[model samples]
Structures are given as structure tokens and as C-alpha cells.
Target: MALLSLRGLVKRFGDTVALDHLDLDVAPGEFLTLLGGSGSGKSTLLRVVAGFETAESGAVLLEGRDIAAVPPHARPLNMMFQSYALFPHLSVAGNVAYGLKRDDVPRAERDRRVAEALALVRLQGFERRLPYRLSGGQKQRVALARALVKRPRLLLLDEPLGALDANLRERTGFELRALQRETGAAFIMVTHDQNEALALADRVAVLEAGRLVQAGPPRAVYERPATRFVAGFLGGANVLEGQPDGAGGFDCPGLAATLRAEAPVDRGTAACALRPERITLRPSPLAGANASQGVVEEVAFRGDDSLLLVRAAGGALLRVGHAEEDGAPPPRGSTVHLAWEAAAVVPLRG
Candidate 1:
């Protein structure tokens, strides 16, 4: 059975809708990441689930029971915020044991649980250390330990690694996932970072303009988006609009070429999303199926790869990913040929 479910959830802030009839389910022991931009309602959904905010309509169900009426403290879940929210005056042990004390747990049990939680987060010897003495990553782990110490049925992480440096964030993400697996607890994380979401989630749920745009495994959603917004948002794919020629192809005016679609698309005006990595660039002019000639407008050298912005014959700006081993990317203003397989073009719905 699903561990948690959101049914027809709707929330508003007087003039703007934050959640529009959103429906989502979290499987038991699953790591689900809610991904979206600011104002996309990802954070709002997490708050509603945690009972920090109540929805105007719809139900928040935990284990098939409606939890809309439950208070935050009474719910079988815990939320760890981005800020860590640690008490500067309290030691790591104190911060982690605060919940147990409030719930009137036995002193001996609280001590045992606090030790176990600290050990789970690799903060075993830091029990006496105050929050001010801990590094950013340590502080995050302290907060995580506090949330996990309660043994909640589900855990909500609101940008848990947002405050850390890129390298530390990546390492902490790995540790966080390991901790979740060790405890076998369900986790619902909210984040605007695409790479983090894709890397940590067992499944990713994308929100757009207060609506659930797409939800699936990372590879599925990244490779085959459901709409134009999803295609452009998830991976910054190149979306080209053109007329369908009724032969499983599109007449794209931007590239001044007829491109073949990987699958049959609906009739009328259609569009396709092509990822930057799918296009192969060459210095020689290559004329064939799914090919276009363009001039390199800009080049961005990432450590492992280079991103080339090419202006096609018909003024279409295409971002192409070139590997470092592909003999250093052509200089800006250099003429280039871009080509891809027919299967690389994914059809998009309006």
C-alpha cells in the first residue's frame, strides 16, 4: 500500500493558486523528490503534508487515512527544514532528544535513541558539541538525526542540502540516501535543484505553476517528458515547433529541415524536444537526415564537456553538448554541422 497520498489538493494565497488539484502518492520505503522552480508549489505541498499549512480543499492521506485534521506534532511524519533550525545553546544530543522529552519518553530510552540517531548520522562523538561548533554539513546531519530519531513513518526534507557548498552537498546527499536506506523509511524531499533531485530520488515528481506536471523515474522523466514545459524545465532540452507532415515527421522552419519523429504524434502543429547531448557536431558540412548546419555563437567549457550554442541556417539557436575528447569544440563564429538519430527527437504535447 502507498505510504502517503495527496488527493485533489488545492491551496491558495488569496489571489494565486499554490496547488491545483494535485494528486500524488508515495510508496512505502521510497525516496520521492518533489522538483520545481520558485512559486511552483513544491515547498507549499511539503508544508501542507507536514501540517505546517493546511490546504483549502482536498485530503492529505497517510496510510489510507485522511490526516487533514491532524496537527503537525500528532502526525506520523517529521520535517527537516533547509535552515537546520538547530538550537545554538543546545548540544547535538540535546537537539536530537528534544522531541522525545516533549513527548514524555523515558529518560533512559531518550538517551539510547539519541545515541543511535547520532551514530546513524556519523556524529557519534559530537554529542557534546553545540550547533555553533558544527560545520554546515554537520549541522544538517544533526537536524536529520533529530528528525530520524523520532522514527516517523515518513520524513519530509525541504532543500535539506541547499545551504552546503556544491561538493559538500553532493557528499551529504550520498550520506542522506544511505541513511534512508539503512532505516527503510519513506522520504519525500522538496528541492529546486535538478541534479540533486535526479541523483537522490527513486522517483521524481515535477510541479509547474501549482500543478503536477510529470512524475516518474529519473531516466523516464528526463528522457521522455510529457509536455513542452517539462522538456524545457527538467533538462533544458531544445524544443522546436513545426508543422507535422503526416509521415511521422515535422517540417521545422527554424532548422529549415524535415525531421523525423521517434514515435507517431498527433496531427496539426507539433513540436519535438532534443537534448543537447544527442546532437553530434562536426566541422564538415554533413547533409543527410536529421542534420542541420549552423555557426557556433558561444562555447561554455564545463570540466567534463563543452556546451556550444549554434545558430542554425533559419535562426534556430541550438545548444549542443560536446565531449572533451571530441577534439576541443570549434571556436565561436566557426561553421559546424549538427546531426542526430531519428530516435533522439521526442514528440511533445501542447
Candidate 2:
């Protein structure tokens, strides 16, 4: 059974609807990422679950029980903010003990639990350090320790590593995943970074214009985007317009080949999506599902890889990635062949 569920959740700020009848579910022990741009309602959704924000209409259920009227202090959830939100004057141990002290937990148990939480975050030896005395990653772990010390059933992380440097953020992403696995807590995180969502989440919920565009396992959402917005937002994609040409093939003015679509079509137009990396570029013309002719317009060397911008025969700009120049890459204004399997191209509707 799912550990948490949201039904028709609606939230509005004056004329702006932050969440439009949003429905979501989090499985037990799964790490779910709510991914969206600013004002896309991800943080609002997380705040609603944390009891920091209330929905204008709808219900929030934890373990099949409604908690609509529950106050922030009484809700069985804890939120870790992006800013760390640690007390400047308090020691790490004090920050972790604040919640326990508020609940008036017994002295011995509170001390024991605080120590255990600190140990879990690998800050056991630095319990006496203040927030300003530690690095960004250490400060983040302290914030996490403070939240986990509460022993909440649902853990809400509001851009948990957003404040860290790129290097630290990458390292902490792995650490956070390991921590979630060790704790077996249902972690719901909010973030706009696509790579972070893909790397850390068990499932990703993508939101756009206050509504969920796609929600699935990271690879499923990446490889099989349900809409143009999702396809373009999750990563880069080459979109092309074409019509079915019978027998698992699609044909248009400039494209002629077989493409994998769910059903047969009749005189209707459809769009196809292909990731940049899915495309294979060849210096010479190729045959079958792996071929298309285009003139390379831009070539950029990005250290480990090269990005090629090609103007396809159909007048669409296609991006392709090449790791380590294999012989001579097509230069600017030079024609090249691009190829890939029919299944690699995802057809998008509307």
C-alpha cells in the first residue's frame, strides 16, 4: 500500500492557482522527486504535505488517514529547507534537540535520539560545532539530522542541496540517496534541476503551469515523454513533424523511414522526439532506420564531449553528442548523416 496520498489538491493565491487539482501518491520507502520550475507548485505541494501550507480544497492522506486539519507541529512529517535553517548560535546537538525539547521528550531519550541522528548523518563527532563553523555539506547534514531526530513518518526535503556548490551537491546527492535507503523513510523532495531529479529520485513528478506533466521512473519519463513540454524540459530533444507511411514507417517532406508508434495512423500529423544522444552521426551516408542527411551548423567542444548542431533536410535543428572525436567530425556548413532506431524516437501528442 502507498504510504502517502493526495487527492484533488487545489491551492490558489488570489488569481494564481499554484496547484490545480493535483493528485499524487508516494510508495513506502520510495524516494519521490517533485520536479518543476519556480512557481510550478512543487514547493507548494511539499509545504502542504508539511502542514506549512493548506490546500484551498482536497484531502491529504497519510497511511489512509486524512490530516487536513492537523497543525504543523502535530503532523507526522518534517521538512528540511534548502537554506539549512540551522540556528546560528546553537550547536549542532542543540539544533537536533530543539524539536525533542519542544515535545518535552524525557532527557535521557532525547539525548540518545539526538546522538543517533547525528551519527546517522556522520556528524557525531562534530555535535558541538556551530553552523558557521562547518562547510556547506556539513551544514546540510546537520539540517538533515535535526529533521530525522524528530522521527517523522514522512520526510519532506525542500531543495535539500540547492545551496551547495556543484561539486558538493553532486557528492551529497549520493549521500542523501544512501541515507534514504538506510532509513527506509518515504522521502519527498522538491527541485528544478533535471540531473538532480534523475540521479536521486526513484520516481520523478514533473510539473508545468501548476499541473503535473509527467510522473514515472526517471528513465521512463526521460525516454518516453508524454508531451512536448516534458520531453524538452527533462532534457534536450529533437522534435520533428511527420505522418505515418504505413508498415511501422513515417514519411514527411524531408524524413522517410520506419518509426515505432503505438497504433496505425490515417492522414493525421504527429510529432516525434529524439534525445540528442540518441542520434548517431556519420561522415558518410547511412541506410535504414539509422540515417538522415543534414548540414552541421555549429560544433562546440565541451571538454569530455562535442555538441553538434545540424540543420536537417526537413529544416529542423537536431543536436547530437559525440564523445572523443571519432576521426573527423562534420565541420560547420558540411553535410552529415544522422541515424538511430525507430524505437528511440518518442512520438508526442499536443
Candidate 3:
């Protein structure tokens, strides 16, 4: 059995459904991320698992036992909130030791666990400092240490890195993932940030309107999204509608051209979701590739890469990403060609 499992999970507030018959499983020591937009039920699912919210009908099983009836503090799980809920008056060590003290654990054992937790989060020497004295990242570490001090079987993170700056969030992602592996605990984090989810998760569950649209490893979900919502939510996708030409290519009427598709197309109003990064751009169309001619509409600089929005045939706006080697992009209004390999196009049901 999986370390954590949610079966037929459903939650509602009056007429609105927060979660809808969702089923998910987290493997032991796996880092699973529930990714979705606000009101997409990611937080509600976390709250349910944390025992802060009760689902209308479902089973939340931990280690093969249903935990639906357990109280929040009684469950062998810990939650770290986005606010980093560390007590301002207590020193870092004191904050981490609070749980042990509440449970009437021995003083020596409490101190030992507190020290180990602090070390795990790389805040070993900062235990003497108060939350107010630490940087935002440091304070977050204290919160994490406090949660880890108990050595919970599963860690629930609700936007844990949302409070940190971009650089600190990136750094903390590495720390959180490392600490999870070190402690051998399952980590389920909730976030709307697609990049963060893809970066930290062993598997990502994309929720939409209280339903799980897709769930898989980051690459699988991003490269082969199951639904239109999943395709857009995971990352940028140029969705195109077309009919199969029976030669493993699409007679795409939208783009006014035929494009290569690796798989034999399924019948129906099918579409192709192409990743912008997979499309190459140049001054002219390639000889043996699926190519389109367009005029550069906009050039977006994103540090390591640049996004070129090209207005192609049939006035379709196509996005293309290329390495920003010289950090210079072709000016708007310049004609360009965008091409992708046959294997690059992902066929999807419309």
C-alpha cells in the first residue's frame, strides 16, 4: 500500500465543491506536490489530510489505516504553513522543543531531537536566536525544525516556501527535498507555482475545479498533459486543433498547414499541445521539418531563454522559446520560421 492514500475524497461548502471524488496515492518517502490555482481544492486537500478540515465523504489512509476520524494533533503528521508560525518570544530551540514538552517527553530527549531538527534544516547554530532576529529564510527553517522535531511520518506543507523571496524559495526547495530524503518521510506540498511544483515534486497532481486533471512525474505531466487544463497549468503549451492526415501528421486547419505527429492520431476533434521550447526558430523554414512562417510579434526576455511570439499563417500566434545566447532577439515585425520535430508534437483529445 502507498504511504498515504486519498480515496473518493470529496469536500463541499454549501453548493460549492472544494474537492470532487479525488483519489491519490503517495509512495513512501516520496515528495508529492498538489498543484492548482486558488480555490482549486489543493489547500482543502491538505487541510483534510492535516485533520483541520473534514471531507464530506472519503478516506484518508496513512500507512494502510484510515485517519479520517483522527484529530489534528493526534495524527502522526506535521504541517508547516506559509506564515512560518514560529512563536516570536521563543528562541529557535525553544520553538522546536515545544511539541516534545507538550507531549511530556524527557528533557534530554527533547533537547536531542531539537538539536537534530535544527541541524537538518541547517539552523544548528541559530537556535539561540529569536524568530524576530532571524531572516525570513531562517525563520522558515525554525518552523521546519519545529515540525521535524517530532519526526512525523508524513509532512504536510501548505505553501511552505510562499513567504520566502524568489532566491530563498529556490534555496529552500532544495533544503526541503533534501531534508525529506534524509528523514525518509513523505512530503505533500500544496502550491500554485508551476515551476516550484515541477522542481520539487517526485510526482505532481494538478487539480482543477476540485478535480484531479492529471497526476504523474513532472516530465510526464508537463510533456503529456491529459487535459487542456493540465496542459496550460503545467506550463506554456501552444494548443492547436487539427485532423489526422493518416500519415502520422495533422492536417491542421487552424495553422493553415500540415504538421508532423509521431503517434497515429485518434479520431475526433483532436488537438496538439506543443511546448514552446521544443520549437526552433530561424530566418527560414527547414527543408525536412514541420515548419511555419510568421512575423515576430513580441520578444520576451526571460534571462536564460527568450520567448518569441510569432503571428503565423491563419493569424495564429505561436510561441517559440530559444536560448538567449547573445541576449538579443529579432525585432518585432521581422519574418521568421518556427519548426519542430515529428516527435515534439503531443496529440491530445479536444
Candidate 4:
């Protein structure tokens, strides 16, 4: 059974619809990340699930019980906001114990739970520190401890690490995953960062315009997107517009090449998503299918890899990501051949 389920949820704000009959499920002890851009309803869905916003229709079920009418404080869940939302006047232990105190738990039990929560987040010695004295990562852990102190069945995180620096964010992501595993609590996180979503989630749910475009394991969704939008959104894929050539091939005007498809496609206006990392660059053209010659229009050298924009014969600039281990990429304006296996060509639904 699902720990939480949203069935045909609909929410709107006068002239605009924030959630459009969306449905999703969260398994117990699972970490699911909601991935989308701005105005894509990722945050709105979190708010709805936290009981801060009500849906116009559909059911919010927690372990088979409808909780749509349940008040925020009455619901057995907690939300950690992007800003951490730590109280300025409260110390670390005070903040973590706030929820327990509100529920009128016995003082002894509250203190014990607060200590455990702080220890879980690795903040055992920082109990009396003020929020201002703590670092960004420290503050984040405090907020997480506060949410976990309640031992709720479900926990919602909205951009939990968005405020940290790049290095801290990456480190914290690994810690967050470890903490979730240690506690065995189900988590539903909302993040616009693709790397964060892909790295920390057991499953990823991609949303668009208040609708779920795709939801599956990270590798499955990344390798086989259900739509063009999903392909471009999750990982920066190069979408090529083409038509079925009445054979087991696709004629893409952008590449000026008839590429072989792994599977037969329908006869109509068709499209394929090619990830940059899948293509290999060569000095000379190879005599086989799925090979094209192009000129290097631009080159960007990242620490571990390099990105090259190759202008094909048909005037399209294809982004290619080459690893540093492959040696230095060709200079700009150099002609090169690009090749990939047919399996790398992912077909997209219209």
C-alpha cells in the first residue's frame, strides 16, 4: 500500500490553475523527488500535500485514509521549506521540540525525542546555538531535525538544499539520503535542480503545467522519456524534428542524414531525443549508419568534461559532451565526425 496518494487532485487560484487533476503515489520508506521548472506546480503540490492549500477536487489519502479535510496541524506530516523557516528567537533544541510541545507531549518524552532528532541530524553538540550562529548547512539540518522529531509518516521537503553553496549542497544531498535511510521515513521532495533530483531519489516525478509527464526510476525516466518536454527538461537532450522515411530510419533535416532507429517509428511527423553524452567525436567520418560530419562552432571546457556545439550540414547546432579522458576536443571551426549507436536515438511521443 502507498504511504500517500494523490488521486485526480485539482487546485486553482481564480484565473490560473495550479494543479490540474494530477495523481501520484508515495511508497512507504521511499524517497521520491518532484522535478520541474518554475510555474510547473512542483511547489504547489507540496503545499497541497502539507495541508497549507486545499484542492478543489480529488482525494489526499494518507495510508488509505482521505485527509483532504484534515487541518495542517492535525495531519500526520511535516514540511521543511526552502528557507529552512527556522525561528530566529528559538535555539536549536527549542526549534526541534516546538512541534512536540504543541501536541502537549510529556516534557520528558519531548526532551528525549528532541535529543534523538538532533543526534540523527548530527547536531548533538549544537543544541544551545542560535540559528544566526550556525552555518547554512547547520541551519538546514536543524530544520530537518524539527520535521523528523514528530516521527510523521510522511515528510515534505521544498528545495531543502537550495540555500547552500554548490559544494555544501552536494555534500548535504548525500547526507540527506543517508539520514532518510537511517530513519526509514517516506520522503517527498520538491526541487527544480535536475542533479539533486536524479542523485537523491529512488524515483523521479516530472511535472509540467500542473500535470505529471512521467514518473519512474531515475535511469528509466532519463534513458526513456515519455515525451519531448520530459526529455529536454530532465537532461538537456537535443530534440531533432524529422519524418519516418518509410523504412527503419528517420530523415532528420537538421542533420542532413538518414539515421537508423532502434525500432520502427510511425509514418508521420516524428522526433527523436539524442543526449549529448551519447555521441562520440572522431577526426574522420566512419562508413556506417548514424554518422554525420559537422564543424565545431563552440567549445566549453568543464573540469571533468567539455561541451562542443557542432554545426551539421543542415545548419543545426548539436551539443556534444566529451569527457576529458577522451583527450582534448577539437578547436573551434574544426571539422569532425559524430557517431552513435542506433540505440542512443530515443523516440518521443507527439
Q: Candidate 3 lDDT, tens digit per residue, 1-350?
A: 79998999999999999999999999989999999888999999999999999999989999999999999989999999989888888998999999899999999899888888887888868878888789888888888988888998899999998988899899889888888889998999998788999999899999998998889999989998877777766787988877888766777765677777676666653788888888887666766437778888899888899888988876788888878874577889998777888778877773
Give per-candidate clash totals: 0, 1, 0, 0
Rate residue 213 of model 1 by lDDT.
90
| Rank list by lDDT | 1, 4, 3, 2
Lowest lDDT sum, 10 consecutive residues, model 3, at 281-290
Per-model TM-score versus the true fold: 0.98, 0.93, 0.95, 0.98
lDDT of each: 0.91, 0.85, 0.86, 0.91
Q: lDDT tens digits, residues 111-167, model 4?
A: 999999999989989999999999999999999999999998789999999999999
> Model 2: per-residue lDDT, tens digit, 1-350?
78999999999999999999998899989999998778899999988988988999999999999998999889888999988889999999999999999999999999999999999988878978888999988999999999989887779999998889999899999999998998888899998789999999999999986788889999999999988778888887876677767655566445444455444433443777788888887657776654778888999987777899988777777888877756556679987887886667777775
Off by over 4 Å in 1: none
Q: Please, what are the lDDT tens digits per residue for candidate 1 over residues 143-206?
A: 9999999998799999999999999999999999999999999999998889999999999999
